[model samples]
Target chain A: SQKIEQNSEALNIQEGKTATLTCNYTNYSPAYLQWYRQDPGRGPVFLLLIRENEKEKRKERLKVTFDTTLKQSLFHITASQPADSATYLCAYNAGNMFTFGGGTRLMVKP
Target chain B: NAGVTQTPKFRVLKTGQSMTLLCAQDMNHEYMYWYRQDPGMGLRLIHYSVGEGTTAKGEVPDGYNVSRLKKQNFLLGLESAAPSQTSVYFCASRSQGTGELFFGEGSRLTVL
Candidate 1:
């Protein structure tokens, strides 16, 4: 069975610093990978999507890199602010089946 | 536009009680899904519908049943609730050829 793993521990970073979160998968590669931002008590909002053929993708201060060789994807937030605090989830779509990781909570402290 | 809407934002059920969760999407999407989220467990797909009157089981479909009588509506039912069923339920939909999913506010269920 395919499995997605994200750091369950909360990540604390100083405001203005770069925050990086990781998502790793096992079993097989996916057609695409996605990152979503989830605030407390709210549904997740799509942030970025990177295809298996694309090495990197960027939107504003956010960037996502997919390393199919490593079966990993890294999500980065540059010049992070306190408002950027939230849980980040990583998901992959294979044959139209989407699988999500447990997500990593991020806290940007001032 | 209300991309996706889920009824009964929250519910509390006793063991063995039965209830249903409703999901509606106005996007006219071809795909809709039901998922459950538990602490540190991520989101597990329970069931999904690809079109009106068509349904399929997902990763965690056990103990749950679904219906897609209408293209805009998907229903999830629990005939006999259990404590292990307690989790936040989310309904999402995506259009054909798109991988992005639009999610609802979520429905929190607690089985005591």
Candidate 2:
């Protein structure tokens, strides 16, 4: 079965450091991958989208890297702040549909 | 600009009741989608439309129906709501062939 996996556990990191999250998938080849940030009791807000051909993408302090060879993607938030704390979801295209993995919650200490 | 909006920002329904959630977008997007978000489940596509009047099933389409009669509006209807269907529903849209998605604030639904 093709499955999308992300860190089910919460991550706690220092405010000034970069926080890295991982997303892994099996048995599927997606054309593109996306990262979204969702706060409690709210819909996800789009962060970045990286095509399979692209190795990495960045927006301000957020960076997303896609590695089709390894069937994985990494999302990094540099200079993490308490305001940057949120659940990050990684999604991939699946036959015209988008599949999202269970998000990784990051809590940056103030 | 109201990029995307969902009617009935919040609702509480009894099991077996029926309701429709309306999503409207001003972005003139060609594709629209509906999804449900639950704890430990992230977001699951319930239904989507590639364009006006063209609806399609998604990963978890069961127990949900959709309509896109107009270019800028999509509706999600629940024939019979259930406790298991209680979730925060989101509406999103993007341009044709573009992988980017813009999302609405969301509709919080509770079933008793």
Candidate 3:
């Protein structure tokens, strides 16, 4: 019965700036959270993942922060480029199954 | 490595027709999943397999049935397709560590 929520609106930002996206959930407490990027006509590609016990995780230009108390996860893309423009999704495991958020489309303008 | 592959990238079926989507993984993963993506609903789990010969229902299994005769393949069957069932389907596989799920390109289906 986990319900994951993300900003359905598209995010527009200029180049060289940071883009931040949010993911929230209710009714279930997941042990870990994950982020993925999906281009048009393709399935989501994995980004970063953070655990409930961990405050943050990072991979190159991508960073993910998890707040268990807030039941939220924040994904940040530093120095975002046009190539990074895609729908970013946040997911959490409900037991062995994965539940995903609605997703936030990040449009990085050059 | 052809992590995950789904058959028939696109398809069109009449209402009340039936179809089966095939998914295969080469990663030797123990878990395989099927999901549907809608405009604003995100990805909803339809069915999943824990291992060879074992399948389980997920968040939205209605109107769909799944079979896993082998550990490497998962099949999702729609008994009677409806317009509402027209959504992009994705297949994914992962191991026990809960690492990022490896996904297929997705199958686009339309029911007229």
Best by DockQ: 3
What does the TM-score come to for chain B in model 3? 0.97
lDDT of 2 by residue, A1-110 (tens): 67899999999999999999999999866888889899887778888989888999999998899888899999999999999989999888776677889999999998
Ranking by lDDT: 1, 3, 2
- Which residue pairs of candidate 3 clash? none
DockQ of 3: 0.92
Q: Interface RMSD computed for candidate 2 is what?
A: 1.1
Q: How many angstroms is residue B52 displaced in model 1 relative to the true structure, after the best TM-score fit?
A: 0.9
Better of 1 and 3 by DockQ: 3
User: Model 2 off-target regions past 4 Å?
Assistant: none
Candidate 1 similarity to native, TM-score: 0.97
| CA error at residue A51 for candidate 2, angstroms | 1.3
Task: Name the weakest run of 10 consecutive residues (lDDT summed) in model 1 chain B.
Answer: B94-103
Determine which window of 10 residues in candidate 1 chain A has minimal summed lDDT: A91-100
Query: Quick one: best lDDT, which candidate?
Result: 1
lDDT of all predictions, in order shown? 0.93, 0.91, 0.93
Weakest ten-residue segment in model 2 chain B by summed lDDT: B94-103
Worst 10 residues of 3 chain B by lDDT: B94-103
Every model's Cα RMSD, please? 1.0, 1.3, 1.0
Q: Comparing candidate 2 with candidate 3, which one achieves the higher lDDT?
A: 3
